[model samples]
Target: MKKVLSIGLVRGVLGQILGTAAGIGLMTAIRTAMGLGWKAEPAAVLGAFFGVFGFLIAVGVVTDWWKWAKGEETSEAEDFQETPGTRRYFGVSLDHKVIGIQYIVTSLILMAFGGSFALAFRTELASSGMQFLTFQLFNTLVGMHGMVLIISILLGIAGMANYLVPLLVGARDMAFPRLNAFGFWIAVPGSLVLLSAILVGGFDTGWTGYPPLSLRAPLGMQMFFVGVFFNGWSSILGALNLIATILRKRAKGMGMFRMPIFVWGVLATSIIAMTATQLIGLSFQLVLFERLLGMPFFDANNGGNPILFQHLFWFYSHPAVYVFVLPGLGIISELLPVFVRKPLFGYKWVAMSSLGIALTGFLVWGHHMFTAGIEDYLRVPFMYSTLLVAVPTGVKFFSWIATLWQGRIRFPVPMLFVLGGIVVFLLGGLTGPPNGTVSTDLHLHDTYFVVGHFHDTMFGGYIFPLFAAIYYWYPKVTGRKLNETLGKLHFYLMTPAFLAMTLGQMRIGMLGMRRRIADYDPAQGFGPTQMVITIAGFLVTLSVLFLFINLIRSARRGEAAVGNIWESRSPEWAILPSPAPAHNYERDFQVVGDPYDYGLADSQFVELLPQPSSDD
Candidate 1:
């Protein structure tokens, strides 16, 4: 019992519960003193703050800093020397690899919740009228689905960045190890706060949570605001840590241009996350304050412009799309050459495209607001900027195809997923230009067509690539490879289903089907299409279930895969043994050649330290 209580996760949960009660009690006391009624929104908001703080404290994320502040001596060990067991994962281990796995587990949990929400709404949409779910509940499910999946995506990328960046860069740990742990641990309380919204009357403003409507949303709306607001801290700080690590912690001879392609992707993503995340947090807080304090930040009648909220929200939200996908795209770039047995085609251009995408991502947020009553003059420029993203994005596609030209390509599970990403993302890219044009967007905006395009982008840019990464790296993390048959099954089932679902959505969307509605008209002739989409949605879920089964069953039972499982040229695989050591690299390495010198004989990406002779 004591051992369990000592676990950071358990302690953090208990602390959050007590802190929540205390926050509510404090709010009640303050209201009583002021002769005002106790409010759920204000109390919940305070409770959220306290809950997160309490969790951080209980997890001991700041213990070393606190000790320093008290003028006490502290151990300088970078490795936490965590005991070898599952219990270490529950506690705050400063090891980057352990933190990475923690992020992956947390992401999967969130994905399960978010995907369940999606299935619920998808079932409701199968037939026009609502089935077993109230309109408000359905609305909440849809909104929750979006936000939860987004948080899951962020965590997924963070997991990839955290685990891969250090080893790839030849660093022992992150530049700020405690900060890395803190950034990850914070997501737990943040997700809990977000999920608590459903119990608090639910927010129906969609993930964007634009104001006016948001100002008048239920008490649960505050939970949603507080959830994403806190999650933003994770993103911002994680990005900061990654940028610092990559810039300062590279192996000897590793330069900015010589880093792995995925590292560049992370670099671009971190830049966006660090700079743009604050806007979303700021926007959500404004709405929270408006609701709790009766401030009119977006209340037009009270002299606040509602459109101002959109500007602030999308400024981060659109770039946030890049934050979610750049790493996946980087994964795609990183893995393509390995399997294709070719040097990454146009390496400099591919590296620069990530930054180009990040920069162009910022100027294109206004495209989402083209019909949101923004200035007429602004729409044209926004359209152009939105269209400009395709250029650098196109460079990536061409380069990938070129890299695969007549090469000895291997179709492993990871490669299958990489290929899947290309096809789906290509669909997403092709469909985007139509929306970039104002006339076409006027027809397609707020319709299932837009939803289809967005899903294509997400699946292609993140989900598929994420699966590829997990499969490719599972061996390194677990010292056992996932079942090839199960992985192939996962891909085949999911790919066809997702493609059909999204394509069906686009087809019906052009026929006038709107988005986010719980029910639709039977006369619209969309029943068959909706049924197909719903069925496909369930199939995708089943496919993911297969993946879960594969992961669990294969962890102990799968083929042992120690030592350069993929025979790749990346630093981590070339040097580290399976299940990578706590501190990655027992000795420092030097970058001696190109990151993806796949076909070059006698070429090495990094030079490992010399081992001492047994005679000595």
Candidate 2:
């Protein structure tokens, strides 16, 4: 009983309840004094803010900072220490590895939640008439589905970054260990607040949360804004920590070029997170202020421009697509050479292409707004820039194919997922130009076609690759591999189902089915296609459920993996033991050879050095 109470997760939840009550009371008291009635929206906002602070305090992330404020000195080594049981994972542990595991668990939970909502809505759309969910409920589900899944993706990327980057760079831990923990811990409260939207009157504005519509949305809309606003801190601070760690903490002789290809993906992603995430935060806050303070930031009736909101929103949102995919794409590149037993065909070009994609991602946000009535000349520029992304992206796809040509290919579960990602993402890529081109976009905009295109990009670029990464690295994280048969079942079932769902969506969309509507017009001859899409959605859900079952069962009873299971050149596999120790490397190491020189005989990627003598 006492041990459970002492756990960080329990304490944080209790703290959140107390803090929320305190905030609601304070707001109610202030309103009483001002002769105004109590309002749920304002109270919820202040409560969410205080609740996050309370959770952090309870979790002890702020403990060291509190001591430092009083001129106290603490041992820096404390940050590297961790408790030896499952309890360590439930609280604020300074170990980067613990934090990384925390990220993976939380991300998977959110994915299931968001995906369930997707299935519910897809059921309602099966026959076009309202089945179980209300019209407003349907809208809320669709919007939350998008935003929550996005949060999952961000957390997923962070998990991969925290676990892999330090090991790759030969550092003991991140540049700032406490900050890394803090960045992760904050997302917990933020996600809770976001989910709280469902309890209140749900909001109807999509995740975009554009104003005018957003201004008039239910009070739950504020929670969405506040939740994302709080989560943004996680993204921003995490990026800062990663950038600093990569730049300052490389092993001896490990120059930027010599770092793992995935590190370049992390570098590019962190750049976008650092600079561009703020725009989304700022845009959401503008809407919050408009709602609470009676401001008119997007109210055209009060002299505000709705179009301006789109500009601010997409500035981060579009580049955020790159934020989502670059790491996943990097995972694809990093793993292909291993499975194919060949060198990455153009290592430097692939690395440079990540930077190119990051830089180019910023300029292409305007393409999303092409149908939204931007200037005529601006559309042409945006069109050209949007197309330019294909060049660097093409570099990646071509490089991957070249690396695989006539090599000794092994199709493990991870490799199967990697190959699947290429084909699906290519579908996404091929479908993109129609939307990027002004003429074709005029027909596809706001339709199911657009919905299909986005899903392809998301799954291929992030979700599929995420599965590959998890499968590839599961042995290193847990000294055991997932069930191979179940994994192959997952991949095979999901790929075909997803293809059907997205393709059906695109096809119906072209025949005049709109996006985000609860009921479709039966008169449009869309009944058969809608039913198929719904069935496909459920199949995808089933496949994911199998994956979860495999993970749980495998973690405890699967075959033991004591050493490098993948037979790869990366330091984590080639040198470290399976389920790497608390202190990742007992002795310092130096980079000695190429990261992906798979075909070369008698070549080593890193050379471990002896620990320093204590007597000296």
lDDT tens digits, residue span 1-616, model 2: 7877788888898888888888988999999899998788888888888888888888878888998899998768444456568889998888888889899899999999899989889889999789999989999999999999999999999999999999888888888899999999999999999998877877898789977889989988988998898889999999999999999999998998898999999999999999999999999999899999988888888998889999999999999999999999999999999999999999999999999999999998888887888999999999999999999999999999999999999999999999999999999999999999998888888899999999999999999999999898998888998999999999999999999999999999898888888887689899999999999999999999889999999999988987777888887887789898877888888988989999899988898887788996
lDDT (10s digit) by residue, model 1, range 34-94: 9998777777799889988888888877888899899998776473567569888998888
User: Which TM-score value belongs to model 2?
Assistant: 0.98
Candidate number with greatest lDDT = 1
lDDT of 2 at 406: 92
Error of 2 at 517 (Å): 0.8
lDDT of 2: 0.91
